[model samples]
Target: MFKSVDLKLQLVELLISSYANVDLSKVKIIGVQHILETTHSMFRSLYLLGLKPENIAIIGKCYSTCKEVFEEMLDDGIYVDPSSSSYCSHKSYDEWFSLNIENFLTSQIDDLLSGKYEKILVLDDGGKCIKALNKFSINTNLIVAIEQTTSGYEDIRYGCFNFPIINVARSATKLNIESPMIAQAASERLYLSLQRKGLKTNKVLIIGKGAIGNAMKNKFASNMEVVCYDRNQKTYDQAKVELSEIINQFPLILGCTGKISIPFDLHSKISPGTVLASVSS
Candidate 1:
């Protein structure tokens, strides 16, 4: 038996609309995720909708650090078992997990199709898992995917996605607050830490000028010198020297672009100590 809990209204509406004709009693969500509050909240929202804790399997490193939350999910009846969870985002946290990403997703899909569940909700943050699911879920009963990151959304937009995709990255409200604020907060912490290390923090070169990128630029401009580069030819044309010269001279380089924006031709020219910090990742 599950306890009565309040569901976030926005998530309630989204889930209601998405599951319109489906029986909520038979739904399961396999969240291939990251360690974030939104992820935790999503679990809560789904549980409140009557999804059994045993039907939702979270596959990621989120289970590594957040022991309390993980225990709460289990205690509350969220579908989590030691043999089924895989939790590694980067090799840096090598002690915590070694990501067997392929094997993990394949196992999840196998279980998803083993007749214990009716529908599956995939929260593929990196977009790679959805691509994996696309191959296996071709003849499945029901599987819905939601791409949570801009990079993942781009992959879907470019036709990597075969199943129905709910691009949460495109939501203006989430775009306006969650991403930008996270980027800002991350950059702030990066700057402070570098400054503490006695590194020069006065001048920062930020690549890309999107919402989060622009927010970082503006936040830094009040107290430091900020330079920008956009890969768009038109934008690049406006500041050719800025991208070429500033990269070589600046001791700190901030990557606002999720993908590499540093031209391969210019890579060797950058100063050896120049730090390449990605606020997005």
Candidate 2:
């Protein structure tokens, strides 16, 4: 029974607390189709913060689901692509439309420089749209970008977008649609299923000391006997485990190392019931 104001406050709290001590006035939100709903929530939150609807703009592909969600909201101040007929139908009012990333970039930049917005908030890496936006001369004083996957991080770094990017790690794209509570319930169900099947603490082995590997290690540590293996000598030393010893000891493995293949004969070392879960990017 979350009220709109409660949801808005939660989003504002997340956005503000995420950057800690940063100004959030006049920010433009950018994302792809999948992030549309989340962006809508953000829009409501920003509006509740006393910002006008005209100050915010969205740049992404127009999809039926997105259209349905946007249409349901009374404040249709979002700027969409003109070629997208679904968005075009509502173009007469507060709607803005563009055909491609190039056009969207041009228009958004103009709006930003025209003393309309002060900050820019990138919700998710909008495919190549982020890269395209990077080529333009943006006028905002501060830029905030969010990343959910390793691929998005690479995109922000390599795209040469001059902005302070924040990586908000999320589950797989499909699982992101479910609320965090629901996803946790689903994970608990899976864990119960495994336990009921007499699975003896699936010896979950993670390979890599990077952020993703560390996250996986933390997640599976409570349910399974977890071991981490990294090629980096220093990291292995820090973890107090040797790769060779791990390779020789366990057959259940998750390869988080960036390497294409495990260094040793992984198949021949483990037992028949050993399970491998790869979390490598």
Best-fitting candidate, measured by lDDT? Answer: 1
After TM-score superposition, the amount by which residue 112's alpha carbon in candidate 1 deviates from its true location, in angstroms, is 1.4
TM-scores of the candidates in the order shown = 0.73, 0.48
Segments in model 1 whose C-alpha atoms lie over 4 Å from true places = 1-24, 61-99, 138-141, 232-237, 241-245, 261-268
Return the lDDT, model 1, position 75. 71
lDDT comparing candidate 1 with the true structure: 0.66
Error of 1 at 133 (Å): 0.8
**C-alpha RMSD for every candidate:** 5.6, 10.2
lDDT of each: 0.66, 0.54
**Residue-wise C-alpha lDDT for candidate 2, range 82-158, written one tens digit per residue:** 43333556443113322355666676676656665566766654334555566677753556666655545554555
Candidate 2 wrong stretches, greater than 4 Å? 1-27, 31-39, 59-76, 79-115, 124-130, 140-201, 205-208, 227-281
Whole-model lDDT, candidate 2?
0.54
